[model samples]
Target: MKRILILIMALVGLTVMMSGCSSQETVDVTADKIILVGTQNDYPPFAYADENNELTGYDIEVVKEIDKRLDGYTFEFVATPWDSMFLALESNKIQAIADQVAKTTEREERYLFTDESYFAAETVIVVKSGRTDIQTIEDLEGKNVGALAGDSYTLLLEEHNTKVDNDIILKYSESGNPAEILQDVQNGRVDAYVNDPIMINEVIGKLGLDLEVVGQALVNDDMGIVFKKDTQGEELKGLIDPILKQLKEDGTLVELSKKWTGGEYIPE
Candidate 1:
C-alpha cells in the first residue's frame, strides 16, 4: 500500500546516491592520479634514488612533464626491478611505464607504445681509453663483449653477433644487472661492454670509471613510454604525441639529458 511504496522510493533514492558517488570516483581518475612503474632505484640518470633516497631521475622528470601536459593529474611511482618491469606494467600494477622503454615491433604487439619519443639513443661499445685495438664496429669481431641479461643491448648483440661469424662466441656476462656487466669490462674480465651511450657516460660519471666510447655506435633507438595494449592508451597516445614533439623542438629533452648524463643528447 502507501507505506510499501514509500519504502521502495526511499531505497531507489539511496541507490541513485550510491551511483552518483561511483561516477564521481571515476571522474577523479584523470591523468593527475595516474601511476608509473620503473626499474629499481639504481638505474641512474633514468630512474634512481637520490642522496635523500627519494626516487628521482630523467624518467621521473619526463613523466612529471607528461603529468603537466595532462591537466588535473599527478604522478605515482612504482619501483620494480628491470626484469619485472614489463610484467608489472602488464599486470596493471601501474597505469603506465615511463622507464625509457624503446619501441620494438615485437613489444609493440604486446604493449601500447606512445607516439612520443622522449629520448633518442643508440648502443655504443665501451672499453679502456687506450684500447686502440678496438677502433671500429668491425673490430669488435671475435672480441669478448658483455652486457646485462635481458637488456636491449642483448637484443642488438643477438642480431649482429652472428654477423661477426659463428666462430666468435657472444658471451653473456653471468651478472644479474647492468652494473655488474660494466664492471666485468672494467676489471678486464671482458674485452668490452655494449650499452646505451648515454647510460655509459652517466654511470661512468657516477663511478668515476675511466672508460671511453671506443667503437662506433650501434642501433639507433627511440625511447617511448609504455602502456598496456588497450583502448585506454589510444586516447592518451593522441594527447601525448604533440607534447613530446614540442619538448624536442624546444630543446627541453636536450637539457634534461645534460642534467642527467652531462652529455649532448640532441635527437639526431
Candidate 2:
C-alpha cells in the first residue's frame, strides 16, 4: 500500500509540473496589419465590378481567403484602373496590388513580387474566327493589332514592333475592356489583339464575340502580387508567400481557377 501510494503521488506531481509548463508557453501574437491591396475593377474573372456594382472576382476572393488565414493581417482592396495601379503604389495610396500582374524588366526594377506566382498567364494572339491570313504576331506586321495600354501583351507587341520595320498598328481603349476590344475586332476595326488565353476565352464565350486564338502562347509569364520596392512591401510579401504555397498545396487555387476562369489556369 505504501509503494502504490508513492507511485500515485509521483505521477500526480509530474502531471502538475507538465500543466504548469504548458501554461507558461507563450503564443505568437502580433498586431494586425491593414493591407490596402490595389486592383483593377474592369478585368472580368480576375477583378471587376458585377452588375450589383460590387467588386468580386477571382483575385479579389483570393485576397479575401488570404485575409482569413492571416491572423495579424487584414486585406482591404482598393479598386482603380489597371494602368493606375502602379501609380497608386508609388504614391503610397496602396501598399500592394493583387491583380493578375505579370512581370517585366522595368517592373522588376521598380517593384517587389512575391516569390511564388499564383497565375500562369499565357499570352496569345487573338484574331477573328476563320481567319487564316494571320497566324502570329510577326504575321500581323503593317496590320492593326489592338492591345490594352500598359498590359504585358502590349509590351510584347511593342518589342516586336521595334525589331521589325513595319510596326503593327496598336489600338487602345481607355477602359481596357476586353469585350469592347473584341467587338472592335469583329467589326473589322482592328486586325487582331493580344491578351491572356483564359481571359480571352472567358470574355469571348460570355459575350459570344467572334474571336479565336491564332497561335500558341507568344509569351508565358507567371502573375504575382506586386508592391513598391520598400520595407512594407518586403514584409507583406514575406507574410503572404507561405500562405500562397499553402493555398496551392491544398488545391484552393485549382478550385478558384475552375470557378472563375472555368478551367485550371494555375502554373504547373
lDDT of each: 0.75, 0.86
Question: What is the per-residue lDDT of model 2 for residues 152-232, given as tens digits with 9 covering 90 to 100?
Answer: 888888898899999999887777677788788988999998888777787888889888998777889999989888888
Q: State the local distance difference test value for candidate 2.
A: 0.86
For residues 142-258, what per-residue lDDT tens digits would candidate 1 score against the true structure?
Answer: 788875555677676676766656433456655346676677777887778877877778788778777889756777888888878777667667777787788778888888888
Taking every candidate in turn, the Cα RMSD to the unseen true structure, in Å, is 5.3, 9.3
Task: State the lDDT at 58 in candidate 1.
Answer: 87
Best by TM-score: 2
Predicted structure with the largest lDDT when compared to the true one: 2
Measured with C-alpha atoms, the lDDT of residue 167 in candidate 2 is 90
Shift in Å, residue 149, candidate 1: 3.0
